[model samples]
Structure formats: C-alpha cells, structure tokens
Target: VDKDRDPVLGEFFTTESIETCADSIVRESIQNSVDARSGSRPVDVRFSVGCVTKSETGDLFLGLWEHVSVSDEEAGRLCAENGFRYVTVEDFGTTGLRGDPEDVMGDDGDEENEFYFFVRAEGKSPKTGQRGSWGIGKYTYLDVSMINTIFVLTARGGNGPVGGSGPLAIGMAVLKNHKLEGRAYMPDGYLCEVRPLTDGDDDEDAVLPFGPDSDMPEKISAAFNLQRADEPGLSVVVPYVPDELTYEELVRSVARNYGILIGWGDLEVTVVDETGDVATMDSDSILAVLGSLEDNSEREELIDELNLALWGVGLTPGDRTELGRHPLGKHPSWHTDGLMTEEQAKIIRDELAGGRSLAVRVPVPVTEKPDDVTRWSYLDVFFGSSEKKANKPHFYRQGLRISEIPSDTVSGLHALVIIDDEELAGFFGAAEGVSHVNVSSETKSFKGKYAYGANWLKFIKDAPAQILRLARSSEEDEDAGLAEEYFHIPEVEPEPEKEDEPETDPDDTGDIEDPVIPPIKRRVRPYTIAPLVGGGFSVTVNSEVPEGTVLTIDVAYDMPNGNPLKNWAPQDFRLDYMTVEVEGCNLTERSGNRITVASTGESLFKVSVRGFGSNRDLFVDVSLSEDS
Candidate 1:
C-alpha cells in the first residue's frame, strides 16, 4: 500500500499569551465572525453547552466510538455512558464558509475559499484585513473537544458553494493515527457523505456532501445538530466537550475581551451554561458586567483598568481633533495641528490637566513597500489621569485586547488605543507573535511584510505620551521638535576600548587599556524603562521572574554635545528626591544616575520612579546587577 496523505497536526496546544483555552476559543470566534460580517451591523454570537441522551445521538457515533476509544479513553467512556456533553457556537450577521468545498489544488485565482480552507487546509490562511490570519485559530476548535471532533454547519451568506446555495453539515475529526481491521487509517475524517465508505470498489476520497438544500439528507443534519433554516451565518458544534471548559469561564472571557465592542453596539453574545441558565450581553448590559468583573488571575486589577477605559471612551467629549498625516520622523512623537480653534486645544489640555478624560482622533500613513503609495488609517486615543500610577497602556485592535507588549506609558494615567481600520489592523496583526497577544515588529510576518513596521509601532507606542506632553505647552512650543534630538533612547553600544597601541608615545598622557572583559549571562533579564508623563520612567518586567534578583537602573539626560553619562551633574537633575514605587520588589539603593532593587515576587515585577526634575528624552539603562 502506497500510504500518502497530507501532514496533520499530531498534538494540540495553546500559546502562552492567551491565558486559558477558554479565552483563546472565545476571542478567535468573535474575531472570525467580525471578519465575515455581511454589513455594518453588530455581529451576534451565542455560546451554548448542554447534554444529550446517548440514544438520541448515538447513531451518529458508530465508527467514531472506536476511533475515540483508541485515542481518548475518557471521551469514549462518556460516549459509552448515557450523558453526551456538547458545546455549540452560532454566529449571525456573518458570511459563513463560502467557496468550493474540494479545492485541494491551490489554483483558484483570487477566489475566496473559506470553505476549502476550513475543510482541509492546516496552518495556512488566505485572509487579509481580518483577524485569525495565521490559520492557527482552526486548531483551537479542535483543542476543546475531548474526542478531537467538531461538526461545522455554516449557512454561507454571500455566495454558497459553486455547486449551489444550501445548508452544509460535516463532522470533522482529527484523532491520533490508528489502525482499523489491520489497515491504517488517516487521522482526519469528514462525516459529510450519505453513507460510510465500506470495503468495496469505491474510492474513499470520493465521499462528499449533497449538492443543495433539497438534496441534503437527514443524517448529515442529525449528526452535527445543525439547526439552521436558511440563515446566513456559521455554527460549530462540538460533541463530548471537555470538562474543564465551563460556562462561567467562557462568559467571563467574552466580557473581558469584547466588552468594549458590546458597549459600542458592535457585538452581542448569548451564553447558555450546563445548568440551563441563560445570559445575554449587549450594549445596555455590558457596562454592568464590566463593573462587576474580577481580576481573573494573580495580583492584577483588570476591573479598575477596564472601567477607566470605558470612561475614556464613553465619558469623554464628542469633539475630536484630527491628527493629520505626518511623516515618520527620526524619533517617536505626535504632531497636533488643524484644530478648528484655540479653544479646542484648551479644552483638551484642561481636561487632561484636571485628571479628566479626553479622547482624540489620530491618523497614520503607511506603505507596504516595494510599493511606495501611502494610505491613511486612523485610530482613537483616549486618556484619563489615574488616581494611582498604572504605568501601562491598554491597547485594542479591531476589538481584540493586545496585552503584554512593551509600552512606554505616562505615569498616573489610564490610556486606551483602539485601532478599527482593517488595513491598518492587518499591519499591526502581522507584528503580533504566534500568540497574537502583543504588538511587536520582530516577528517574521511583520518584518517580511511592512516597510516601516517597527517605526510605526514605536510611533503608536509613544503617541499617547507625546500628546500629553505637548498639551501643557503653547502653540509655538507645542511640537518641541528640536527637543526630540536629546530624547533619543540609544541602544547599548559600548565605545570601543582604546586598548592596542600602534606605537607608544612618551608624550601621550592617556594609557592604553587592557582587553575588554566579556559580560556574563544575567540571572535577571532587564527591560527598558517606560517614560512617565511629567519627568521620570516606569521599569517594565515580564511575569517569569524570581524572588531575590537585583536590577540596576541607570538614568541620564541625553546631551547633544557630549556623552550623557560623562556630562551628568547636579544642575541637570538630582536622583535624591526621586519618588519610587516597587511592586513584587523592594528598593535597596539609589545614587546619582543609578538605583538598585531586590525582587520579592508575587505579581509581575515592576518599578516606577519619578522626580527627574527635567525631561529631555532620557538615556536610561536597566541591567542585571548581581547574581541574586
């Protein structure tokens, strides 16, 4: 036997950025539905979980029972018992999986083939201007299934399959490679055809679905529990849903991840838990849900952060200033111009100064070169002064919360940046890593695709801080453009040691130096400090940190003429009066231009220190000081 088949995933896993399987699945579902939206309306998605009697759905599990037992004994046992747990997600206001069903040969010219991709493709995508582009989201569905099976029942909106327009139902399963009747069977199987392929002259691959709604058989509908009556949307029904995934987890994730969308009337979700309790989330009820949300995990206060963001978006004034297209300059900064009147600027500044909320419209121009033409994409920036120092910014791209990225935040301020434009969203989406939880330009997708990807990212990162800084200045001094030269954060490049002397001169006053000692591997990983609104900066750290490591933070004002460190003096600024904040760490020592800390871990290690007395684009260095 020639045994040839497409490479299939042998194991299922989730990325670290997404906290849990529940969060991953819910976010992916909403993202995909929004991408397939038929029109400019709120996309409706419902999550339902229930149990069914084995006798009602047992016939659908004939051959699957054996395959399930081979790989997942627990799922097989559940099937053997009377209780059969299931989860179904239905999305209205969507264009379901549309295209040719059997497009295995990738020769379709500019044709949208969500159907073929959903049916067969693995770890690939034909998506642009839409979320879930990396093609990793499809596997997330399979991960929550105990028996590695899910049923796809999509009523495509725009155009049905090339064959005809009708409802489609298919049972998709990806089990561990196994053998049946002394012959090896492939892991992927579809329950679309009328009858199971038996030992005969017929080819197994030819097993497929009926053409139209009239021709569709009862078995296909019965197997997947596809309860669509010519509605335009998609449905994913999973049988034997895992025990760990509960209604409470799913609903909470939905609220945290998409609460903003719900408040904006962009999305609505309904959930029916195993206990038969039903809850619906929409624009009216989302705020109530958010007001009562929990922190979800350790040491973080997400509710306060979320409520403040809602204030920035919902409570801020309707008047907006257009931040027009400005070239990507040498450094990260914002240019605010074209305000209708001076009063507009005054209002914006006064609100921020009073610790109130202010929202502004910001537009950015970008190009994917080899092509030079630029297009405009705008995003919303909301700012509210916080009672306590957050030292972080909340970012959302097309209604998805992008967290854990390195951001230079203004101390004592709550900031929210929302990107809605599809074209620009794609640019930032590529910059995200495999987890899709951060915005960074180091990834292959961003570096390979965008011309100024990294520059644009830094521009957005510094946009909020730059605006807040400029609001305190007059029109003529608004930009402070020249000041940016001194504010540049220089990458560490030690001046080359003048060690080897070509010829020794008696008159030479300077002595030749010894060879440079190699720097040791650090026990404490150091991240750059985020600049605050007024003068100082907040040190950023990842969650994976130990309890007793020392970190050295060195700071100096960048001088255009001489070395920042060598030229530092008491007149420039004093570190003596600095106000320092330490979380999961304790301050041990502070001197001129340097501060040391000993970490005591619980929450993510973070340190915010103010009172620089001067702001000139600081030259800061944070390094692992000791061996712990």
Candidate 2:
C-alpha cells in the first residue's frame, strides 16, 4: 500500500540530535521485542552487525519490482551495486506478527493481525502495558537507515488459521522514490509491501509471505541465520547502516541503559560482529559490577525493595502500594508551600497518590569515606534502576527507556524522575499513541486533564526542595555527628585560673622536656582531582579539615600524567563563579584564583568548579574532632 507521510516527518526525528543514533536504534527495537513478549518467557534480543556483498543484498530484492515500481533509478542502482552493510535486530521467545494479511481493516479486533497494524496502520499499537503507545518510535529504524528502508521476516510461533499454520512473512518498507526528471507527480511518501509466496495465494494484488506448513522455510531461515524451522520469532533487517556507527557503542549503550533489567533476569541482550560475539549483557554480571562499588548501607534496604520489585519477586500488598509512593518518602507538594496555594497543593498531593511507580535518589560520585553521609546533588533524586545515566536522563514507559531529557535542562547534579504510573503516563505531553517520548523540553508543565486547576511549572520548580528536605532529613538521622556539628553552637570554655597559673615558663620547670609539636601539612594541590566537562577538573581542598578551619581552594587543569596541562593552565578555568552550598558553614571569600570558606560547626562542604565553565561539583564531607 502507498502510504504518504506528512513533509514534517522529515523533521520529526531531527528534534533530538542523534549523536547516539545507534543507541536509539538498539533501545527502540529492543523495546518493541520486549513489548511483544509471549507467555512468561523473557525476551531474548540479538543485534548482529555485519557487511553484505552487493549481489547478496540484491538477491532478496529479485521480485521486489513486481509489486512496487521504483522512480529513483540511482537509489535502485546503488542498492544492487553495493549490496550494503546492515545491522539486524532480531528477537526470540516472541509470538511473531500474526493475523490474516487480507483483513487490513477489522471492525472486530480479532480479525486484525499484528502484520496489518505494523504494515498499514500508523499511530497505533496492539499491545497493552507496552512501551510504544505512540507509533512514532518505530520510525527510528527508517531514520537511521541510509536508504530509509527496513525488511521484516517472521514465522508464527503459535497457532494460526488452517492454511496460515506455520506461517512465515517477508516484507519490505521503504520511502517512496520521488521522481524529478519526469512530468510532476505527487510523491507517495513511503510504502510497505510483502513479497509473494505464490501467485494464487490471495485475492488481493499482494500475496502474503507464507510457507506451505506451520514452520519457517529452510531457505529464508538459512539466509538470515534465523531460528530453525521449529523455532518461532521475528527478524528485522535494517540496511545501509552508517559506517561511523559501530556495534560496540550499541552494546555499551544497552549495557548501561538496560543493565538493571538485565541484572534482574528480565531480559538478555547480545551483540555480534564479523569477528564473533562482540558483547553480551545479562543480569548476573551487571549485579556483580554494582556489588563491587563502594557501599551505601543506609540506602541498602530501600534498594533491596527496588531490586525485589524488578525481579518480580513475591511482595505483600503494602510493598506493592509502596511502589506507587514517593521513593524519597516525600511528595512534590511538600515543597510547594510558598509556590502555590494550600488548596492547590492539596489537590496535587491527592492526584500524585494515584501513581503506581517510585522515584530513586542516586548520590553523585564522591571519594569514599565510611562516616560521612551527604548527597552531592541538590536533591540527589532520579528515577531508574541505576543513577549512572543521570548525565542524560532518559524517559521510559514500562521499564524500557525511550527519550532523553535535553542536557541543557539537566544542570548541576540535578535529579531526574521517570514518570510511569498508569494514571500519569499520558499527562506529560506524550505523542498521539506513544507513551515514552515527551516532546516538551521542560516537563514541569503537565498537559494532562488532572492538571487543569494546578500549576505544573510551580510543581516542577518546587519539587526539588521537597526532595532535598527529605534527603537531608535522612542524612541527619543516619549521620547525627556530622549534622550536629554543622547546626549546633559550641559552648564557651572556662577561663584558666588567673592567680595559680601565672605564666610560668617551661624553662622554670627543672629538666622538663618541651612537648613535640606536629608540623602543619600543606596541600598546594587538591588531594583529589575529578575531570569535568570543558577539559577542567573539580579540585577538592582540605577535604578532612576540622570545624572552624579555613580552607583555600583552587580550580585548575591537570593531566593524568601528574603534570599541569600547561597549554590549558594559562587559560583561566572559571572558578570565580563557583557556587558554594554548605551545611553548617559559610563562604568567607571567593575570588578568581582562590576561595576561602570557614565552617561554623562540623559541616558538609560542597564546592562547585564553575570558574572553569564546568557543571560538576566536588563534595568534601568534613570530619569533626574536638582538640583536647
């Protein structure tokens, strides 16, 4: 069928810069596979990136012209001449696209098939509780392919109609080749047409791709390296993969983005190149890596609850309900006292209670010390299985990440909350049918109906304060010593006895040895230098200084070889505008080259290296001690 797309389709996917185009392809395709999961089997997805000879690729196109005529001769010629290198994402343990090909429109939903919807329908999905509510995410494949085309091959893993049993379908979806030389003709935009299994297969001009019986044909299975005839699944072939994009990056992105799901036995993703199996990600290995990081015992219990929910472990009714509550143990309205009317906030609080997901707070990375408990971010809050991806907060629908919040919107160790409650899914400016991608750069303003009376921007602005309040409260209870020092006043010491202790010199005491005095250790450079954006490092000065101690901090560029990057050193790294936020302390002075801060009590020291145009923060959790 000829499906004309709006001219705007060209600019739709361009909204987000595709630096990680391969990553998007991997995520989007895998999300579809996972959503089409059948029975209790976890989706097993594989990405195979390899080159193909010109003739080899053209072999599948042998009878393509029989159905749709090509207008762009050069494009047609290039396909046959170069064949093409391709990235194929395939899934096992899924019921392959099923249904009668002729029944394109079905008033009765049962007669409609997955193939019909995917091939003919736009802005629709058949799966419930799935990530792809908007059909737009499917275009990711076409957008990444140089030819703007994709091939689908599938076999019914389950039962089909009498003649449809063991059905296998091969189809191609391609953007229409608009002609420029001939008399003007309206462009069809794009069209999807399946290869014919036989001439008399169906009454429609098109013939559905099906084998004689209930299993995939040997020839098709062998060409694509698909499951044996007995096994059932779907394989998607994306041709003309950009040379700059590599399979390794795709593997890494999957591991980082979906590692949590992998670790919890929810799914398995593997990537292969010409050499061999390039990389594989599973649940156990990811868990091992997380277990190796420095521990946070205070968050361990809550983390355990999250882990349990991920693995589908049996839970009590209370635990299930708790999943819908605020992960940091505070609602967004709690910080809206000054931002909104009490009645408005009360309405927001009541509406938020209808959600069915949790928010997670992940601490910014810091030098490990057992006693200190302070979060580096303003709120230290984010949503997901892990906090490492906080730099680019991704949006997910049903545990599958879809879009990333623009980096410009994420600043200064800020928190990212993934919204996934059934009640709240459609409220965040999601596209027509997709629940994952939110077109709005700013998410504070809710577009859903429940937000009619409430001010969403106010909620977004004030939610951080609420998260910070709860986080700070938890920190205080867990580390009372540090909190007490930062906020409590010290008692004055008693004066020495005036008469009895009249300034006696040590020399007057016979044979008295002078007490040994320790020499002061000066740290000219930071004890730890963390690299941030713009070739600068976040330098922490006097990380272990005592209460009331004055600290001098300098932000500079340093090389990994322990030498100053001389070329970069002369250029000023903007540390003058470094924003300082302290608990139980104050900044006495801040200038271009140096910063001086004094502690009132034991305090948590947080110095941001803004002088260098870097957005990262250095957390120096001070240790407290009373000198005798």
Residue by residue across 1-628, what tens digits does model 1's lDDT show?
Answer: 1112233343225344577767878988888888788889899998987777777664566678887776666766766577777878889988887876544544323336777667756655678656667655777788778787887776766543564555776777887777777878777776766443333335435444544553333554564454566777888877777676778778888887887777778899988887879778897887666555554432233455556556655543355565545655333234334422466567766777677767877777767877766777877787766654435677888888887765555555667887878778888888775556876676556785665668778777666655654454333331223434435554554544344545667898887788556554334334534555555666766554677778877778776687878877866655544456555676778667777888776555766666554535787767754443
lDDT of 2 at 535: 21
Where does candidate 1 stray beyond 4 Å? 1-14, 72-79, 106-111, 158-161, 194-204, 210-227, 292-318, 321-349, 442-444, 469-608, 611-628
Worst 10 residues of 2 by lDDT: 360-369
Candidate no. 1 TM-score:
0.69
User: For model 2, how does the per-residue alpha-carbon lDDT over 1-628 read when each residue is reduced to its tens digit?
Assistant: 4432324345445555543777678767777777678768668888888777755443555644322345444445554445567788888787766676555453324422676666555544455334554445667877677666666666665655433645454544555544444644343232223454343445546535545452334444455565434456677777777876677667655754565456557788878885665566666565443343346641342233235335333334332211122223223333222333344333333333342233332222111123333222211124223322112333434555444442222223323444444433333333322324434523222233232213332333234334333333222222324323222212233434323334667668578667655554442432233433322233333455567765555433333443232323424443333333333345666554555666554434434332233332222222233332
Model 2 stretches with alpha carbons more than 4 Å out:
4-8, 63-77, 80-83, 106-112, 127-129, 161-166, 180-207, 210-220, 228-230, 287-396, 406-421, 425-450, 453-465, 470-628
**Candidate 2, 295: how far from true, in Å?**
21
Error at 89, model 2, angstroms: 1.3
